[model samples]
Target: MNIGTAATQTGLPVKTIRYYEEIGLVTPDRRANGYRDFSEACVEQLRLLAQARHLGFSLEECRRLLSLSADEGRASRDVRALAQQNLEAVREKIASLSALEAQLQRLIAQCHGDDAPDCAILDDLMGQRGN
Candidate 1:
């Protein structure tokens, strides 16, 4: 089928599908008119990519996962290692976001949200207070 058909089947945008093909993620055949001709296997791969992306897998990580997924007897140890790495990343993101949230809360609490020319929010941002 065409790219549109494949997009409908996989629920992915046509641009994303083209990007996947360009990045060697999926190699769909090209017709004489130069239109992309997708196979069922390629569409299935696209569906897998969409699912992996939804789970927050990076493109390179997804590529590695795709490689591992192809192996029927893939080592569990490898999968475990990747999962651990992703866990660490998620933990770090949570820490950074928490810190940002605290700072924002402090800033907002100090802000005068009223209609005043002398805004506390601007003052705080300009390093007038908070030593």
Candidate 2:
């Protein structure tokens, strides 16, 4: 099929398929006088890349995983380890965000939005704004 057809089959954009070719991810054939001629295997490879990317794998990581597609004894332990590390990072972010939310809520409560122009929130936000 053509490059456009391959893109449609793989659910990737035409530009993305072109970029994959440029990055040595997929190597489709060239027709006489030079048009990209994609094969079924290329479509499958693009689909695999899409799925890997959707699962948060970077391009280099996707390449590594693709290389393992041929390996019968592909050790998935490394993938699991990466996933665990990412989960821990996410949990840390949640904790940090929770603390930030608490601090913001306290500041908001301290801010008495009345006519008297003595703003505690502004003082906390800009330490230069003298209390």
Candidate 3:
């Protein structure tokens, strides 16, 4: 098949598929006419990459995962550890966002939004309120 067929099979954009190839993720064979000839294995690899990206895996992480997936003697624990690390990072981001929400709510509450020029939100942002 061609790159378009591979992109359709994987549900990835043609540009993304090209970028993956540029990044050494998937390598389709080149025909004598200098066109990319995608194999079934290449399409399968693209599908796996799509799934991994949907799960929020970085490209480098996906590369490691693809390597481990190809290893016949790979341990399940290794995959679990990587997933755990990603989970922890997600949790940390959630906590940080929650804190940011709270701070924004506090600032908004302090602002009266009236015709008066005394804006508490600006004061808070300018360090006049000492954060």
Candidate 4:
């Protein structure tokens, strides 16, 4: 199959598939005319990559996970560790976003949202001490 068919099968854009190829993720062969020739294995790899990316795995992590998946002798401990690391990163992001949400709520609550020109949100944004 061609890149278009592979993209359709994997639910990834053509540009994304090309980028993955550039990043050494999936390596589809080239035809005599220089067109990319995607094999069944390549399409399967793309599908796995799509799922991994959807699950928030970075490209580097995907590469590592893909390697682990291909290795029949790979220990489950390594996969578990990687998943745990990603989960920790997600937790940190959630905490940071929650803090930001709380701060925004406070700022919004302070704003009167009336016809007056005075705006607490603007004051806070402009580094003013109080409004």
| Highest lDDT against the true fold, candidate | 4
How many backbone clashes can be found in candidate 3?
Answer: 0
Instruction: Look at candidate 1 and give me any clashing residue pairs.
Output: none
Ranking by lDDT: 4, 3, 1, 2
Instruction: Report clashes for each candidate as comma-separated counts.
Output: 0, 0, 0, 0
Between candidates 1 and 2, name the one with more favorable lDDT: 1
Off by over 4 Å in 3: none
Which one is best on TM-score?
4
Worst 10 residues of 1 by lDDT: 115-124
Give per-model TM-scores.
Answer: 0.86, 0.63, 0.87, 0.94
lDDT of 2 by residue, 56-106 (tens): 667887776667764778778866765676567668879999999998898
**Model 2 TM-score, 2 decimals:** 0.63
Report the CA-based lDDT of candidate 4 relative to the real structure. Answer: 0.92
List candidate 4 segments past 4 Å from native: none
Tens digits of per-residue lDDT for model 4 on 39-126? 9988989998999888788999999998998899999999999889889988998999999999899999999999999998999999
Off by over 4 Å in 1: none
Which structure is stronger by TM-score: 1 or 3?
3
Q: Each candidate's lDDT (Cα)?
A: 0.86, 0.81, 0.91, 0.92
Mark the 10 consecutive residues where model 3 has the least summed lDDT.
81-90
Better of 2 and 4 by lDDT: 4
Model 3, range 1-131, lDDT digits (tens) per residue? 99998989999999999999999999999999999999998898899899988888889988988888888899999889878887887898899999999999999999999999999999998889977
RMSD of each: 1.8, 4.1, 1.7, 1.5
lDDT of 3: 0.91
Query: Which 10-residue window in model 4 sums to the lowest lDDT?
Result: 122-131
